[model samples]
Target: MGRDFEAADHSAALIEQVQEAIAARTTLRIRGADTKAALGRPIEGRTLDTRAHRGIVSYDPTELVVTARAGTTLAQLEAALDAAGQMLPCEPPAYGGQATVGGMVAAGLSGARRPWAGAVRDFVLGCRVVTGHGKHLRFGGEVMKNVAGYDVSRLLAGSFGSLGLITEVSLKVLPKPRAALDTALEMPAQDMPCKLRQWRDAGLPITGACHVDGILHLRLEGGEGSIRTAQAVLGGERGDGAFWVALREATLPFFNDRRALWRISAALSAPLAPLPGQALLDWGGAQRWLKTDASVETVREIAERLDGHATCFTAGVADEPFHPLPDGLLRIHRQLKAQLDPHGIFNPGRLYAAI
Candidate 1:
């Protein structure tokens, strides 16, 4: 039982790569397993693989915190947490279970429980990163605390590795719920959102909610009494709890289609709006995944009208996977990019071509 928990510190090696790229005026593509490769815009550069630096640095089950090197796979971290009966509340996806800890924070996509539990960024406590300047720096700490300046740690979340190389991260965790229940009710698609809102406002133990193919899928968490009470009130047939995992990992039959996929983030009550293909509602309509053959403009325009924005998950379907930012926001992103990776040596064009 003497497996090594101490990970080799490869920050020096990563920092060296950044320094070399900076001196040569070339770019560096920060990567961890490359599992989220298709999730962002393409960039050309020498790959800075983080997998060589892997291990759980420190874990405190009593404090509900775990810090691990970026190269450590989510499954690895989850195994440790599972042993302690704790979990990463964000429920980040690990497609084919190859997603690494760095990639999880970089991609920043969460599962159905995200609405109730919080997001990947929300659980991020701190991180150690190698900036474009070829310097190693640590931000935040093991515990949640006030950050006087930049919250660069959490900012790395969903950054697609454009910011810098995230070598390690400290994340807040939570004990598993005492009891959980999964159920599904057949209902009109349009009514699902409203009902979910009602339940949320009433403070039910509702943790996961989705409506796909006229079935409102639900997950209840908390004590046994609370789940049982909610289940009785909601009155739905028992559902396969594994369904949530499938959706989280993008393994559901709904995602098997070759059609381009659009992720629409809108208010919980946002309408499905017209789609070129079909839509699956998750997070109780806060998120809508559409399988469509429509043009990028059509998909984004629909999301805009709903006061939301759309991101294309299918590469080559859109020049920019993420929705375009306003001129001012774009400028700020460029500024931050310059400040961190002044030479633009880190994952150039990974987030946007303009940046």
Candidate 2:
């Protein structure tokens, strides 16, 4: 649906390239639009760009299933979905660039609707991957044992291409809400969580919630009657819908400061504590974005106290931008990498140091 471009299938060439790289005993740095260049650790390998192998392979608006090549841009997919009156409810961010479908899945990021809807992996139904063995394989999507995309397709969502080359993917979609409204309330960060709980219990069609600088922003979505009822219950001024978009893209004024920004994710009920820096609560207090010069150790310590982990968003601030995995879990990661990439040819050390 993007620009009415003809469907291009470069799987043959892509597989051949993988085979050549494997035979030559070299590594591969998988890139799709390279919009998240500063996200994870840098890799050293031959670039395997997936931008040319583009187009939607199959799309049935009625079935709510879409299959597209990795090279398809997010904007393109969204535009097509928009025409069909549907959307990817996870609301993946474009990061102010031409973010590709593969890159969005690889990053496994979700927007303000994440806590209400679900994460990227939740919508992935299947994937076509080029393994390090140079074999083209398919996983999930009416497969054996894996239900609800619990197999390789879901794992690759946040794998950052460390597992293998994602050539194509199938995702489930949802229809647009019938009605929506944004509301704002001036309340302390500490009290917003309790208020959100009350709304949830009362069955208020809450979809997105974020708090910053004494303002609690809430989005109501559902039937028109529900919206009207929730509006009266909320009793606040009309809020700016652009707030969510700006926050999702990190273009908000809060992110303008030149300091290391840390994303702290804890339980939804985690107590609000005064961080050692400026903090904005999002996801109904499930995620805290902190902009501070605090040492990595100190920031992580605070996160751990809340039974959560902190990931550095700013590049070069920490060697490992991801949270360290437990020894048992880390061993599994290494084993997975070894199984999929026997020659260690795919984005080595991109996710962790050992793998």
Candidate 3:
């Protein structure tokens, strides 16, 4: 159960290596580095390092799509994208220098811009993956609107490498904004829901907005004239100053907790309840990062009541860190797992233990 993982430095080599390992009945704790290793249960297997599958396969700025080996670091990708005046709309967090493209899709960690732009899965056009039974298969393709069949590439996102080892990924990139400005206002915590609803209903095209402490920070982008118009329409609710992005990035004191980190995706109006420790609100009140000692059941019950779910972003052991599946859904998951990996040579019991 130690964090003893290895790296396969090349895309083709990693795929072949994974296939060979599966044929040999080798239990591999597949990983890019160790950034997201704490996400799932520490497997009782030797590590399969895919970090060696690095570098971009292709990048077409005119087409707004980039294909890169799964193990390419997010930092490297971002720098490349910046040079081309483009970025991943998903705004994935680097979370240390080790988080790779594969880990980002598997972990499904999107930043504040997620709601404004789209999720990681939304941009996944295609991928080449090595399945559990030592088979290399290509899912989807390089085209965006090619939904001619099941969207396997998108499904691979958030699958946590439990289904397959992603060798290469094709993602849709977005143009960088021409102008950007941030505004903060002193707003009451209780007024956040109403403010968010009003602002969203207004169609202001605000890039990001979040309430922390007693201040509400909002980000605006696009043409300078349009941003100015937005600021005028926003009225006296705007004040200059504060790094909302860093706070949204969860680098502030509120996120420095060393306890179990639970990410609760619930209604914007979900009443903030007291936990063992502090928490940070983001994504217009929908996403909450809590540092607490509350039992999974306790947190899950609260989320369930509010028509949402809670996942343990960081934790030790829990009964159910993710939202449990009903009988019907559980049956479907089992069927799919059987179809893709009958032997379960992949990350066994990743999303759930019984599976």
Candidate 4:
């Protein structure tokens, strides 16, 4: 909930504007449409909208690189890449269907295909960002193997705009799979924790797996034969609950209800750890989506016992959902933030208090 934020479309113009604001010691909350702005704690500053700066700048299919302004929508990028038979491989879930490319990277939100395809950070080729002092800087390169400097490109992926306001980004895309098959199993609700682990350890080529309500849904993608073979090996019937998988991604009901949502990420084989309330299985058993009436601390404690952490995937109030990091890690984060934004003007207090 940034109260005094302003939206800007031009990157160069934004740099000058933010620089002036920084010189005046005005804290700013950098964003793109505020789609996922509530992801972290609420900030007390001016909100800078990076939307209106949308569109693909350069797309070199031969090099598998697509560069675009930060405000570019994932839908637009995906549709264009789909026509070209290429994709952003990271499988970023469209948060409320309004998530901009910059928002996606800032939040580092990924879908079920993450373990196989890669995380959002992995696909990031490079980025041009505006620092706290309103200085525009570029990191990484269009080429994947280029490791010239501090690897600042990937660092900004999950920084949630705390490090800087990403103005332009270039990502590596991959050719779409030859075929895709959605399949499922009607396993009992209580049996999924074991079944999912068994499937993962059995080495089935499952691209996506989740147990919602009472049905176990799986998505298989590859060559036609490979998809069919994998489906048959998993012994799943053709699915009638494909939409449930989609619901898990955008979290239709949970988002609407504004329940205290908890995203527990743990080992795929982690035992059926007790949760304080209703839970849905997603990303196989590696990720759990919980809707609970308990306090945030209660949910976090449960995750800690299971050797995992809980994050507020989406909620109304701005509060810390993650456990406090150790002093050593905090030192590094503060140092980086200081170097990038000495005045702490970019998304101040967004991720952590001092980051």
Best candidate (score: lDDT)? 2
lDDT of 4 by residue, 275-304 (tens): 777777776677888877778777877777
lDDT of each: 0.87, 0.88, 0.75, 0.77
Error of 2 at 272 (Å): 0.7
In model 3, which regions exceed 4 Å deviation?
1-9, 146-149, 233-249, 268-277
- C-alpha lDDT of residue 233 in model 3: 72
Please provide, for model 1 over 238-271, each residue's C-alpha lDDT reduced to its tens digit, 9 standing for 90 to 100.
9768888998889989998889988999875567
Q: Is candidate 1 or candidate 3 better by TM-score?
A: 1
**Native-to-model Cα distance after best TM-score fit, residue 270 in candidate 2, in Å:** 1.1
Model 3 worst lDDT run, 10 consecutive residues: 1-10
Candidate 2 wrongly placed segments (more than 4 Å): 1-6, 142-150
Winner on TM-score between 1 and 4 is 1
Clashing residue pairs for model 3: 6-49, 8-49, 8-52, 9-52, 10-52
- What is the C-alpha local distance difference test score of candidate 3? 0.75
Better of 1 and 2 by lDDT: 2
Candidate 2: global Cα-lDDT? Answer: 0.88
TM-score of each: 0.97, 0.96, 0.90, 0.90
